[model samples]
Target: MKVVAADSSSAILNEKFDPLTIVATAAVLVDSPYREARGSLPEPIYADANKGYEVIVHEAELCLNLLEKTKADVVHLDISLGAISLEELSPIQFTNMKISTLGKQHLLKILPRIRKIAGEITRKYGIEVLAIGKESIPVRIAELTSGANAILYACEKTLKENQPVLLGLPSKCQPRISDESAYLYSLMAAEHDVRGFAADQSGVLEKVHISEVLNPIARGFRALRIEPKT
Candidate 1:
């Protein structure tokens, strides 16, 4: 089945390697073989890290935006609520879930907006939007896709601001640059071929130098230090 999914990844890190802002969000369409994105829509948000929950609304909107370009059997959201129908999700229904109080409150605040978008997607395209989260391979692809695009965005930021950016990648993923594109490949077992890539049409990769480093605070997560080439 063709699946569309959305996720945000990477971050602008502080001196202490704590994330300050989320760098990019992506929506991808994946078909059978389920290895990589067939098509994708990516956006650079640079949103505050403390307000990370707010990015989901943008992710949903990106999925909707992507649906305009291609057809899909379903849309998967990174909400992680048992693959429930996002269009029908109600605040009353959240009370019984095992989520923490803060997370529940955050979802409650965004439910109306998210449901509105999900309803539109369902009504316009006759496909359901599921809150399947990370368990769905498509969502994992979206995360990698977003992380790949985040590398380009970080390079642009570093060049424009004349400073450096520390980017925290998605868990257990590594980056590879080929031709004019940057790609993030899943390192998790059984996902050997699952990967995502972003084109560097503007040649951002040439303008910056990137170094990989292990995240000191977050195990299993890697980071990139991007700086303008001197």
Candidate 2:
């Protein structure tokens, strides 16, 4: 089945590698044998990292926006709530679920907005938006897609501000630059062919120097040091 999924990934990091802002959010359409995105819509939000839960709203909105341009059998969200139908999800449903206190509170705050968009997708397209989260391969693709695009956005930021920017990439992914595009390939086993890429049509990759380093405190996660070419 064709799947559309959305995720926000990558973040601007402080000197201690703490994330300061989320760098990009993306929605992607994936077909069978889904190892990569067939089509994608990516946006650079640069939103506060402490309010990460709010990004879910933007992710759902991105899924709806992508639906306007293409069709999918289902939509997957990064909510991780047992793949429940988001349209039918209610705040009361949280009582039975085994989620942390903070997680439940965050979901409660965003439920109205997410439910509104979920209802719209169902009524307008007759497809269910599942809170499948990371279990869905399509959602992973969306994460990598957003991470790849985040690199471009980070480079642009460094150049615009003429300073170095520390970027934390999604976990278990390695980045490569080729053909004027930046790609983040999933390093997880059995996902050798799965990758997400963003084109650098403005030649931004050439205008910056990027160095990859392992995040000291976050195992399996990597960071990039981006500096404008002098």
Candidate 3:
């Protein structure tokens, strides 16, 4: 008994390898990378200055979604909820509220299916569908999401700047992580409690305000934000 106890003690003292931490690898599908580019690097939809892969989705192009080329834990839709003006946009100055209204309605009709596809994809791949867009897109997504945070993304700058004048949205961000990956993962986690995003590289991110993203959209766009259901 004494000899065995001594041997056990020596083994414990001679342990070499360090402890291992639990790690999770996640993949996200982004349809469009055109909207938010900061310098040469594509600014992730959500990322933390202090950590890794909070949100990393490649540009999820809508044209290829039908082909099943991408699978994501969470998808950042590329479809803009606002409309493209047929009323001679070149002549119309300032914001086109009327045209935007038409766009939102179209977005509304399209989203239920988007929700369905999001749900279907999440079920098939065991992931979550995140309904994100400039300003109004999230609102429409939230309407379908039923008091869920499924509707979230960086807001447009005009709304952020004119928040006091024209606060179009009803609810706040609902205490969700604003970082793109965190936002994406949270929605995914809401569905299946997944673990991580794929952007694990060092120095893969930069910082900017959410309001900054919204600014360009309000100015004008031929932009689109897709719903999985659509």
Q: Which parts of model 2 have CA positions greater than 4 angstroms off?
A: none
lDDT of 3 by residue, 132-188 (tens): 333322222222221111122222322333321111111222222233432221222
Best by TM-score: 2
Ranking by lDDT: 2, 1, 3
Alpha-carbon lDDT of model 2: 0.95
Model 2, range 169-220, lDDT digits (tens) per residue? 9999999976399999999999988999899988899999999999999999
lDDT (10s digit) by residue, model 1, range 34-123: 999999999999999999999999999999999999999999999989999997788888887889999998898888999999999999
TM-score of each: 0.98, 0.98, 0.24
Greater-lDDT candidate between 1 and 2: 2
- Deviation of model 3 at 132, angstroms: 1.4
Candidate 3 CA-lDDT value: 0.25
Distance from true position, residue 37, model 2, in Å?
Answer: 0.4
